[model samples]
Target: MKYSTVLSLTAVITGYVLADTPATCSTTGDNTPIKSGCCPRDPSKRLRRSAREIFARTDSPTCPTPKFYGDSCCTHEFAKPTLDKGTFNLQCGANGVADIVNDAVKVEIVGCDTADDLTKETCILQISSTPAGSITDTHLEISTSAWTSTKYPTKDPASWSYTSYCVKTTGVCQVPLNKIGDGASALCDKKLYIAYHTSTSDGTTSKTCTGDGTLIPGQPGSRWWEYLTLDFTCPKTCDGWCCCEKPVTPPPPPPSTQVCNIGTAFGYADGAKNLNGNPVGPAVCDTANRWGWYFATSETSLSGTLIVGAGGNDLTKGTTVGTWSATITGSDITFKYDLYDDNTNGHFDLSSVHVYASCTAPTTCAPGKFTFKDDTLTGSSDTSYTKTFSVSGGTCSTYYLIFHASVNQQIPSTGTCPTPAQ
Candidate 1:
């Protein structure tokens, strides 16, 4: 609400004085008796008018001269007039308090029949005060949800079931005397009230319901329920800066689509089956590709260096063997890695490997940050094997390496065993 300043009257004095004993006036106009009875005349023309005479004259009546209470000449007793208390009716204005001004404030239906049912319908009232102004007080009231001729328990039985009230105040509003001043006015008080009603259909069924309450003054106990009244006086003047409006948040941005690049390799190794049906390779063969050849592995080093080995048999040694190595790379949107076998000193073979690269923009092979998949082998034979491969690349955090290898046998009767079987 806007405020305007204007000159207001301070006080009004209405009455007249009397002259009885030729009083002397001081520099400041204090009436002091110069000579008692010096100007006295007939008793009927007494110098000072009696109280009755002063009361009879409505125009320019003189004020009564100061008289001592116990003076022999003055024994009149004056009684003070009594004043009547006043009552005021306050009603909710149209457009609610919002029409008062723009300010940051929250209004909600604190008491509702069913909260869930009102989720879609918000009983929220909002107000905005200018940066130069603030709402400092709020008042509320709630009437009976449904009126009943029957009396219900109430603090004030005289007003029971007829009406209920609630109020709240803050800041300057709490002060007994404070007016809305020019420039910026502070919010002081708020009052609210809700009314209840009932409906009957065909005089058979009666339904009672309560409507939303309105804010007003003079309701009982309304001063207690005002939800919030904030302090808006900023320590620093926000001359150019206005309070930010409550934000209307939009739904979160849609989930991002993910793209991946992958690459993979596989390998295997092979060796002859012993008389016990157990596969056997050289002690150094363990250092080399074995019957299960996926990647390099040593008793000392878990991940051994990749190597290519020669294959042949030492017949006198009764060892059957052959060695091979395989590697593959390609691009695909999707790829996976599975290990088929890990062998030493034998032929190495790899299943088809898949590779993929993904980018929101275009593909770039930045070192150390590229994405890719590694290979793993699960099964193998004495001379053959298989493995699974996976792809990695394109926005991947790491690249994978995969492979498989196997070995073939050379019979000593054929004299095909190389010296020491290089």
Candidate 2:
């Protein structure tokens, strides 16, 4: 039989088969009704009762009745709703079936200030359902089209395409939304989560699904979709001396040395005697057992001179006396005088003695005098004596001459000696 004819016959049979009482069978050759089962006592009542049952079970019955021989008993349908396209069917069922299409997820941005460029802006989009509740195969075709004051929504998405999918199990399909400026002449709006589908048991028709998203104003080229708010401002730059640099420190100066010039000089008078008291020895005078001259002087001036001298009457030679002269130069001055006895007499004698002299200053004279050694000088036929003196520093000065002569006789040795006077 033809497909349409078979369907009509099956519908009629199914209607009668569901009745409470069974119908009797008609036999062609026997000329009598087969009474294997009870017949419908009232065809009109049975037909009315069957019609009521069909009508009552019409709304989403447990199993859909097959329209044709090979029609499926279980079936499913799907539809998608979007902001721009409204609602439409993605799939249709064989029987009269109706299912609700979940509302489209929405994304919007609010609380934005255009004047404060660095201020954070916030946006919220309501998701129809939790994304994690969806199965792994579920996916959403989410796309956003922005309209600047200079642009329109009718423009193709590829021109400013910012599209993604809600395949991830976490987070809202709704995008956090934000804009740079206020809606002066045109509003900045976006449409998100346009389409979505979930895998089903048949692997053909998708399950029920919905999504939402939001958009946030963020720094350019940043992962802004993840954040609910963002701050926008011009980048900072460094120039001139603002960069990282260290201050320079100067090195310490070298150390200095102290400078000074030093010099010294010394002078002495000789009072040494051998065999007899006489000036006979080195210019240096002995400090013991003899008559000698000692003098000392010092000055800090750069240049000077000094002088010293001694004279005395001789007892061996009456009316006879002599002197010696000593001079010094530069910043220092020194001199020495010696006395000797030419005669072999047992008397101590001194002759013309000029002790010291200074060329730098003739007016300034150093102290000069004759002194006997603290210890006694004793010799049977020989005796010795010496004297010494010195002058260290002095300014430029001249030296004057002075001298003294003396004689000491412990043993009387008479002799007529000529006196040397100066």
- Candidate-wise lDDT, in order: 0.24, 0.25
Highest TM-score: give the candidate number.
Answer: 2
Residue lDDT tens for model 1, 1-422: 21111111111113423334322322121333112221122245435544422111122223233431111121111211111111111112233333222322222222111223122222121221121222222322222222123522343323433222212112111111111121111211222222222121224433211121222223365321111222221111101100111235689984433211111111223321211112453332222322222222211112222222323222332232322333333332232222223335433233222222332211222212323433342223222432323333332332322232222222224343333322
- Point out where model 2 deviates above 4 Å: 1-97, 101-126, 130-133, 137-167, 179-193, 196-422
What TM-score, computed on C-alpha atoms, does each candidate reach? Answer: 0.16, 0.18
For candidate 1, what is the lDDT? 0.24
Who wins the lDDT comparison? 2
RMSD to the true structure for each prediction, in A, is: 34.8, 45.7
* Cα lDDT tens digits for candidate 2, 299-387: 22111111111222123322211123334445343333232333442223322223333332222222233221222323322223234
Give the lowest summed-lDDT range of ten residues in model 2: 1-10
Alpha-carbon shift of residue 333 in model 2 (angstroms): 99
